[model samples]
Target chain A: MWLLKLAWKNMWRNRNRTAITIAAVFFSVILSILTNSLQDGIFDNLIKNVVSFYNGYIQVHKQGYWDEQILDNTFEGTSALEDSILALENVNALAPRLESFALASSDTLTKGCLVIGISPEKENSITELKNKLKEGEYLNEQDFGALIAEGLAKRLKLYLHDTLVIIGQGYHGAMAVGKYPIKGILKFGSPDLNDQMLYLSLPAAQELYGAPKMLTSYVVGLENPSNLDPTAEILRDKLGNEYEAMTWEEMMPEVVQHIRTDKGSLVIIQGVLYMLIGFGIIGTLLMMMVERKYEMGMLVAIGMKKRKLMQLMLIESVFTVLSGCILGMLASIPIVFYLNRYPIKFKGELAEVYEEFGFEAIFPTSTNPEIFLTQGLFVICMALLLSLYPIVKIARLDPVAAMKK
Target chain B: MNTVIDAHQVSKTFNPTTIPILAVNNVHLHLERGEFTALVGPSGSGKTTLLNLLGGLDKPDKGSIFINGVDITKLSPNALIDFRLNNIGFVFQSFNLIPVLTARENVELIMQLQHKDRREINERVETLFREIGLEDKLDTRPAQLSGGQQQRVAVARALASKPQFVLADEPTANLDSKSATNLLDIMAKLNQEENITFIFSTHDVRVIERARRVITLVDGQIHSDTAKVSTEVPHTAQKRTP
Candidate 1:
């Protein structure tokens, strides 16, 4: 108790030095929290974007369909197939797709496009497609409708009720043709996906594409994406060799690979942040140690134990560092949330870079509590490490030489 | 009478070069339970070194020092600290009060070291400061106090824990003659009334006068140990003819 008083009093003995040191720790913690939070938010957004666009945690398909993606090789089952999947637990949203590649023409502008036939009533229950429409009404059951990507519509000079001519290799390499009026234009999230996608009713697309008994894939969303791998494995075992189950990670291997490769570089960034934090904390701790040197000497010379002096130094350091780190974290929570809600807008070339990478031009964030906790833990740990040196130096100080000052 | 401090042929050597420089050479000493002893010497005479060895603040090259019948030399660094906390007090030439602490708080430092309760420390601090004429200055930090007041605060700190021995290293060196006289008078009173041992390493004749016994050191060895005329009796200044 006596030593605690001394340690407390000793910390404030040199006001200028102590204050500067504490300020260094405070700013270091703040920078660390901000950088880590921003990075966490960015990474989380990347995953959410990819998941929303195509793969919803898991996808079920005929074993060879994923590799070939032909209209003939699809799992064509109704409620029974869905029941088998739903029986396994945690199947949140299931979307059945009848897919084909076709050349769409309007005013002599002909471009190859992937037309995915969907049931609008079921698609809304399965994916975010309903919410992605930017023009007119969504895919309506009453109309022989089609939802084309915004970019594809722009290229075809299309609008609602504008006829689009679709030509494709139908059943058994036979030519098939269809004329469809665009019911809606989808504001497709990924720029790449937007340029090539077209949606239609299941029955209309089956007859038009001449694949009356085929379905290309089943896209399933889960309540928790973390169960993706386990759920895929379970479905593969139950559905057997005739059908293959894939997680979102497998559905977009390129995106997964990008994240994996980025991990190495991100570690380098974390290291740089830690080093920057180290300098701030260490600089402050060094000053704190220096200011206390004389007091340490007196304590030793006057009958306080050397070890007690060391303990006093540690107590002083931990108090200052933890207080600053906790305060910084408390201040960061709302800022992260507000930023997450209204993402940072990018402009010009920067927006182009994001679009090229199939992401929104806005720098999206995830306001996860883990990000703040992890960052605060790192800063406090760093402060504790920086503080250890002074305690060690004090324990070994020579009282005679110390008192001479 | 129980001896508060007992030293046997204690030596402290510093290596200035290839040859060892003997700081305190084979000095044997004892302070009885209530004795007020002074160690007087010129500069570099190792007065502070002897005091350090007695306080367990520094290690000696040879011999053992015991305080309150415990052999401090044999104790580990940590144990030595525990020993110091419970057994000894110090008053430095510079007063050496932690500048951030109040006058009473400085006095309470030793009691805290002894693991005394806050109320006990506070009560003792209040009484000690009041006794030393610092009752009104109890809450004033060291920097706010005058030199004499700071020294008095230090004196209060030294006695606050009820330590067996108080080692003062030239405690009056920085004080004005009048302040020095007043400090010595208070210390002498404490020694007479409370039977608390006060050991001073000083060149100050005032301190020597107040001490019941004077141990004179020359070249790190004790030159003489002479009993003073009486307690509270000031030493007559004999003008040395140049």
Candidate 2:
């Protein structure tokens, strides 16, 4: 206890030095926490927008359908299988899609586009397709009219109630042709998706493709998409060998790869930041140890053991680091919360670039407690590591020689 | 007389490879209990080195040092540290009190290291402070104390754990003449009243005059040893310096 008292008093012996050291630790801690919080916030937002909005967190398809997504690979889904999947925990809704490519033609233009057939109610619940309508009404199960994205409609020069022709190869090389009135025009955040997507009711698509009661994939929504892996595993186990249950990471490895690459770069940045902080702390400790050399020698020569002196020094450092970390955390809370509430929004070409990639150009800060705790622990661990220099120095100190200085 | 410290032909060398300088060479010395001894020599004559060896602050390259009949050279580093904590005390030339600690706390530190009972430590610190005429400055830090008061506090601290002996290296070297006279008076009184053994290294004539026995060192060997004739002097013989 007296050791602690001595350490506390010793720390204040040079008030300016102590304050400068503490300020270095404080600012570094805040920078680390805020940087991590903002990165996590942006990643979370990206995942929510790109994966959950359209791709679903997980999906189920025929074992070979993902590799060859043609009309022939479509499966006849049984109601019993769907009911079993719905019974699983966190499974919110499933939209079965029969997807293929076709040539879409009107009076002025002809373009290659992806044709998707979906159940109106299930698709609406999963992708919120109804909210994306730019014109006309949403498709019903009984309605045979198709819903096309606004970009595709503009290219084809078609309006609501106009007849558009879709021609393609059906299952087993069968010829597929259809003329359907446009029931609705939808807009998409991604220009790629907007220019190439057309949706029809499942039965109408099955009829046009000369295949009845077939589905290419089941896009599964969840109550909590963050628990994607475990849910995917459970689904895989339940679905057996005929079907493959894959999470968004597996189904769309491109986005996962992009995020992983970004994270790797961020980790390098964080490493550099920590190195700078470590060097700052080391510089301060070096100054302190150098200044206290004579005092330490005197203490050791007076029958106070070197180990005791080392303990006092360590206690003093921990007091400094713990105080700095706690204060830095406290100081960062309001800034993080405020940034979270009012994110920095981007405009002009930057906003267009973000929209091209299906993201909004706003930078938000995360309010997750784990971010602060992890950053605080990292700084403290750094302090502990840097403290080894002094401990080793004291351990090998020659008191008789030290007193001469 | 019981010998409290025995150094058998102790030798220490510095910069052995390049300079090969012998700081203390083949010196033999013994100190009895209750003796106030001074090691006197010119600069670089090995007085401080000899004091360091006797206090177990440095190990001699040759020969063994014995305190209370136990050979200290054979003790491990950790054991030597424990031994020093229990048996040895030191007073540095600069009155090296921990600048952060108060006068009372400085005196209490050695007793705390000994794990003495709290009430006992407090009582002893109080008595020692009162004895040193520092009762009024118990809570004053070293920076706030005068040179004489700080030296008195250092003395109180050295005696706090009741060690077998105290080694002071040039204790009065940094003090003004008045503080030096007052410090010598306090240490002399403590030595006579408590029968505490004290060994100090000094070039100061004042400290040498006050010591009961003086051993002069020249070029790393003891040149002369003399015991002063007994003279009756009052406890307050040296006038106080404020």
Candidate 3:
């Protein structure tokens, strides 16, 4: 107890030096936490944007449908399958979709387009589809019209209430043909989806394709997206060999690869940041050891064991480093929370570039408590590792020589 | 003889592998309990080196030091430190009180290191402070105290653990004449009342004058050893055989 008191008092003997060391640790912690939080935030936001935009968190489809996305591979939509899935934990809602390709024509123009038939209200609950509407009204269950993408509308030179025609091969070599008025025009953040996409009511699409009561896939919405992988595994097991359930990560290998590549670069940057923090702490501790040489010698000469002296120094350093880390974490809480609430929105060319890549141009910070705890712990460990300098110095110190100065 | 410290044929050489300098050579000395002694010497005459050897702060290249009947030279480094803590005390030329601790804490530190009972430590510290005549300065840190007061605290610290003897290396070198005299008076009073042995290495005549016996060194060898019989000594001083 006396040694502890002495160590505490000794740390403040040079108040300016101690304060400077603490400040260095404090700022390093804040910078590290901010960097980690921002990195996690940006990646999470990208995944959320992609998932909610179209794919949902998990999907269930006929075993051979994803490999060959033709009308012949469509499965019958069963209420039992949907109920069994919804009964599982974290499964919020499921929207059954029939997807295929067709030639969309309007008077003078024609283009190859991807067509998706969806239950209007169920799809809206999962993807918030109605929020993307830029003109006219949303589709209903009995509607005979289609919703056309804004870019596709421009490509075909068509607007609301225009008669659009689609022609494609239906199940088992049946001729598929449909003519319908455009009920709404929707804008999508993804340039690829915006350029060649159209949505029709489930009944209208089934009638045109000559495949009634059929679905290509069941898009499974989740109450908690983080549980996507485990839930998908459970769904896959429940559905047996006839069907396959895949998480978004499995369905979109390109997106997962992009994230992994970006994370690799982020790791290098974070390593550099940690290196800087290590050097800062080492430098401060080196200065402290130099300045206290005489005092340490005097203590040893006065019958204090070298081990005891080292312990005193360690305790003193821990006090300083721990306080700095805790304060840095507390100070960062508001900044991280504020950034998470009001993300930084990009402007002008940057915004256009993000849209061209099918992403939002905003940057946000994550408010996860784990980020603060882990980053703070890392910095503290670095500081403690640097503190070994004093212990080694004390171990090798010659009290008679050190006392000379 | 009630000898507390015994040294024979002691020698210390600095930079043995390089330019060798013999700091203390062939020094022989014995200190009895309650004796106030001085090692007087010119610059580079090995007074401080010999004092260091006696205090177990440094090892002698040859010979051995025995304090309280234990051969300190034969002890390991860790054992030497523990031995020093339990058996010896030290006061440096610079009045090296730990600057961060209060005068009371500075004095209490040795007793704490000795693992003394809390009540005993407090009582000992209070008594030492009072004996040093700095009772009111107990709460002041070393920086806030005068040089003389700081040295008194150092002396109090030295006596707190009730060691066999105290080794002081030029304890008055940095103090003014008045402070030096005041410090000497307190040390002399302690020797008379408590029979606490004190051995100092000094170039100061004032310290030499108060010492009951004086040993002079030159060229790292003891030149003269003399004992004084004072007629003006206090009655309490008669309790010890000098």
Candidate 2 accuracy as TM-score:
0.88
lDDT of 3: 0.87
lDDT tens digits, residue span B1-242, model 3:
58899898999999999999998888888889999998877889898899989999899999989998899999988888888888788888898888888999888888888889999998898888889998899899899999998999999998887888899999999999999999999999989998989999987878877999877777788776778524222221222221
Residue pair clashes in candidate 2: none
**Candidate 1 stretches greater than 4 Å from native:** A1-9, A141-143, B229-242
My TM-score estimates for the predictions, one after another, are 0.94, 0.88, 0.91
lDDT of 3 by residue, A192-253 (tens): 77888899999899998998999999999999888878899899889998998988898888
**Model 1 reproduced share of reference interface contacts:** 0.59
Q: Which segments of candidate 2 are over 4 A away from where they belong?
A: A89-92, A100-121, A124-191, A194-212, A222-234, A354-359, B229-242
Backbone steric clashes in candidate 1, count:
0
Interface RMSD, per-candidate values to 1 decimal: 2.1, 1.0, 1.0
Docking quality band of candidate 2, CAPRI definitions: medium
Q: Would you give me the overall lDDT of model 2?
A: 0.87
B161-207: candidate 1 lDDT, tens digit per residue: 78888999999999999999989888888889888889999877777
Best by TM-score: 1
Instruction: Indicate which candidate wins on DockQ.
Output: 3
**Model 3 chain B lowest lDDT segment of ten:** B233-242
